[model samples]
Target: MSKKGKIISLNDFKENRKLTDPDGNPFTGVCVDYYDYEDEQKEYETRYKDGKENGLCTRWYENGQKEYETRYKDGKENGLCT
Candidate 1:
């Protein structure tokens, strides 16, 4: 399968052509958040490719307060911080 924009599972995101860092490692960031749903892991993690954030990710409290904001590049975080 091409596996592009397929919306695979979290494991898939971590195992597939996962974003890497400057050292060719996995690019990563943590967005801490909260939610009322049963799912406790409400935060979003910023992803990256070659040390750049290039994907959709955000952090908001379960009550709906934006905890943090970020940018991405080709599926990685590369610009700004909030």
Candidate 2:
């Protein structure tokens, strides 16, 4: 997937510093997190804006098949999910 947001310093995020999107829209918070089970080869990832899931979230099975995918807007599911 194409990267959608600007990169900011970790320190800024840690300090709860406000940020702006590339287009200069303000964001009160942002975060991305990943979870992996190395032994099982499973993984999951999600992104957040303003303290809520506002982007793609995905999961993968241990066998390498995509387990699921969903999109979010303001922490609520907003598009196709599979």
Candidate 2 segments exceeding 4 Å error: 1-42
List TM-score per model, in order: 0.40, 0.50
Q: lDDT: which candidate is best?
A: 2
The digit string of per-residue lDDT tens for model 2 on 1-82 reads 1145455432254535433554445444434333443453547666667645678888876566889999988767889999
- Number of colliding residue pairs in each model: 13, 0
Q: Model 2: clashing residue pairs?
A: none
Estimate, for each residue in 25-45, the C-alpha lDDT of model 1 and write its tens digit: 454543223354356546555
Clashes of 1: 13
